[model samples]
Target chain A: MKSILLATTTFREAVRDRVFGLVAAFGLLLVLSTVIISPLTVGARGKIVTDIGLASISLFSLLMVLFVGSGMVHKEIDRRTIMTILSKPISRLDYLLGKYLGLWATLFVMMAAMTLIFACACALTEAEWKPTYLVALGMALCEMTVVTAVVVFFSSFTTPVLTSLFTLATFIVGHAIGDLERFAMVTGSAGMERAADISRFVLPNLDLFNVRNAVVHDLPVHSEHVVWAVVYALLYSAVLLAISDLLFRRREFK
Target chain B: MMTVLELRSVSKSYRSDFLFRRMPALTDVTFDVAAGETFAYLGHNGAGKTTTIKSLLGLIRVDAGNIRVFGHAPGTMAAKRRLGYLPENPYFYDHLTAREFLHLAARLNDMNRSDAKHRADQLLALVKMDHKANVRLRNFSKGMLQRVGLAQALIGDPELLVLDEPMGGLDPVGRYEVRRILEELKSRGKTLFMSSHILADVETLADRAAILNGGTLRRLVDLHELGHQERIMDLKFTQLSEAMVGELVRRGYPVERRAEAHHVLVEEHFAMAGLIDELVRSGSRLLRAAPHRVSLEEIFLREVERDVGQTPEDLLHRTVDELVGATSVKEESTP
Candidate 1:
């Protein structure tokens, strides 16, 4: 019960911050830019909008997850508010979970708002709402799980600036997992292949949640595939959160 | 009797630099706060007061010994439920109103929705902050912020309150109000362990005070014993001639002649009663006579200074004995 309240409180506090406004602006501009870029494609207006929307959501969400989520614990400690929270009956794990849930909820709210705007634009322009929009949102939610996990992992025992840098690097590496593995196979270098193998397992394969190609090209998305991706996201989030909780439990409040 | 909190020879050391040797923050510091007692933990800056508080709260792990707060480990939730703590410099969510912040704290302490709201209201009102309950805490004055902090600490109606400098930044009026509230808590049979450098407030408010310096327990002043010092009798009369002074001196009284008046100091407190009666009977004019006791501030300063270079173990025991003796002195000197 306490952890839930803590999580809710964190969510409320984050919404009041300036980053939420900036992320919203970025989301809105991305959606408008898609509208302008749509006419430039031949026989692929739908594909163009889908590509732009997916990329825009990923970019903005990564920023929210990396920058905003990364600062959740740091700000609490920096402001000395953790002392007040921990002085109560709450445990360190509960506080950490609260922080994770709070930032995750904030990201959800931001993504939900941007998704609705993008959906509205797609509907008005095409004169029909695509069911793929819901699928895209579901994929976006799964992707957030991984993004939030990475942010949380970096946030543990690291500064906000450093965490942001590392999380962004992880995001880039996560997106290149397939390419790196393919490159390693082609290069036939044992060391590089071993590095690629380790990187694939260690980093989040954000590409798994990258459903733009399927949604834009009108390709079929299997139910089992979506389920598998959701499961991976959930497991990844739990692992990262567990690690974060461990690091945070030992951290002395300043 | 169950001790509300006990620190059994706890010690903590902090390394000065990443590569340097460790500096002891507390050395074999031990004390217990029983239920319903106000224990004043006093010390100057760099003293072990804050370290002790942190150890009790389990914020800093002790290098040696044990601490039992309410019969449970300090960091355990079971013990924490019965404890309310106010950090020295309390930090709260700036965007949250006083009421919201306290309510949030209450909820986190496992108070149900309605109970949390009612308790938050009662606490805010108790701190005289009900008027500003709706105002964002960031805009609050320091005193108001401290009051809100105090209210938050009291959310669970904690059995033991560990206040670290709760009165530090408050104005005189705020300090008095806080003292009054603490006394009221004491009346309710709650244990309070408060830390502060303001000796006067500690002297006035604490039932028993333990002083520390350089992470060592210098003294444990039982104010009850310290209060035993008697109010001395002082008599002022018109200046007496040398012969008159000599005559009065022969009466077994300590008489000193001043330029304008004569001071008659008596060791026997009731001597005032006898002298006053004799003076009236003899038709002698009585200028003024009054009783006074030395302030605790004087004793605290003197004792602390005297024990500056003493070992922690000896200092603790000596101060405890002196406190007992001081109280007996008060009881003896009262007439």
Candidate 2:
């Protein structure tokens, strides 16, 4: 119940920030630019429009999470705002979960708004409307779910600058884990393969959400894959949130 | 009276950034605030007052000892639900308006929507911020922000209020307003545990106070008893002959000459009788004989200065111990 209030507060704050507005407006322009740039590509104009539009959505949403979410918890601690809230009946878990949900809500809004602009750009560029575009955007939102959780995890225990770097590294490592495992397998390097094996349990498989290529190219993606990918995102986020709670519970907000 | 807040030999230490050396923030601090009393937690900068407040509020884990609010552990929801905290120089969400911030705080405390709004409205008016309820906190002045901070702290209307430096960083008018609001809260039987360097305000509002110095509890002062213990008297005289002045000095009273007035310091009330008899025999004109009471500032400074007068060896040993991370067992302070 408190988490919803916190979520609305977080969403309101993000909406009120001029930076959020500026970035959002810029994101809209970037998505619509697919119209101007779709003619530049030699191949299918519709495919180019879809690719650029989807990439814009992914990039802008990740940027918002990195820039804003990294500072979410730490800002409260630094400013001593959490002092009053925590001094109330709110548990550390509730506070953490509230902050987590709040940040995710903000991410959800950013993704939704970008998706809306992407859809409009699709119509403006005469690109065929397909459900895959929605799926591609939804997968990006899932990826953002992981990224949002990662930022909160790091921000719970560290500074904003470090949180951003660590979250970005987590995102990069999560996406490259698959290739890293393949490379280790091809070389038959026991140590590297072992590292990759352990990473599967530790790092998120963000590749599960990378359906932009298959989505834009009209490839087959089973409904089960989408369902399982969302499940994986939720489960992975829960693990990260639980660890974050443990760390946060023991924190001294001095 | 029921004990609303209790700290039993609480201690805390923070590790230094460079050497990871143990820097003690609080040591063997023990005090309890009774119901319907305003207890002042007094300390200078870096004197562990905030550490103690945070310990009581469960914002930080104390290295040793225990703290309870309403008989529940500090961090437990049972304890928290009974207390409200207003930190020094509270920095809330700048983007949030005064009403929005209070609404969130109310909801966090499990208040329903109608109750939250109603409480927000009441608290805003209580803090005299109803006129600026819609103003963003980022645009508020320091004193205005403090007013909002106080209102939010009272959102739950808890049984106890833990205010750290509530009067700090405020102008004279701001201080007056805050003190007035605190007085009203006190009138309603709310227990207040506050820390302030303003001794006048402490003396005005606090029923009792505990002074912390050098990470240790220095003294637990009862203001009522302190005021009663001051027995010195100041006797002012005019038109006293030089011989009378000489005789009075010989009789052991120090006379201070201020323009036309001769002031005599009477050490005790028993001595004042003899001095007055002598003055009457000498036909000295008595202007006024006023009782001299020691101010809290004087007491506070004396206590803090006593702690500052450590021997060179004690200082060197403490520094080395801090550098080497040595644990020294501390005992409870005697009042």
Best candidate (score: lDDT): 2
On TM-score, the candidate that comes out on top is 2
lDDT of 1 at A27: 55
Model 1 chain B: weakest 10-residue lDDT segment is: B325-334
Model 2 TM-score (2 dp): 0.88
lDDT tens per residue, model 2, B53-137 = 8888888999999888899888898998888899999998888999999989999888999999999999999888999999999
TM of each candidate vs. truth: 0.81, 0.88
What total of clashing residue pairs does each candidate reach?
Answer: 4, 0
Q: What residue runs in model 2 are displaced by over 4 Å at the alpha carbon? A: A22-32, B230-257, B262-291, B310-335
Error of 1 at B18 (Å): 3.0
lDDT of candidates 1 onward, in order: 0.77, 0.83
Error (Å) of candidate 2 at residue B144 is 1.0
Which residue pairs in model 2 clash with each other?
none
User: lDDT tens digits, residues A1-254, model 2?
Assistant: 77677778887888888545734675556665665776677768877777777887788788888888888888889889898888988788888888888878877877777777677777777677798788888888999998888988998899999999998898899999999899999999999999999888899989889999998889988899999999999999999999999999998988
* Residue A52 accuracy (lDDT) in model 1: 70
User: Candidate 1 DockQ score?
Assistant: 0.47
| Pairs that collide, model 1 | B225-B327, B228-B330, B228-B331, B229-B330
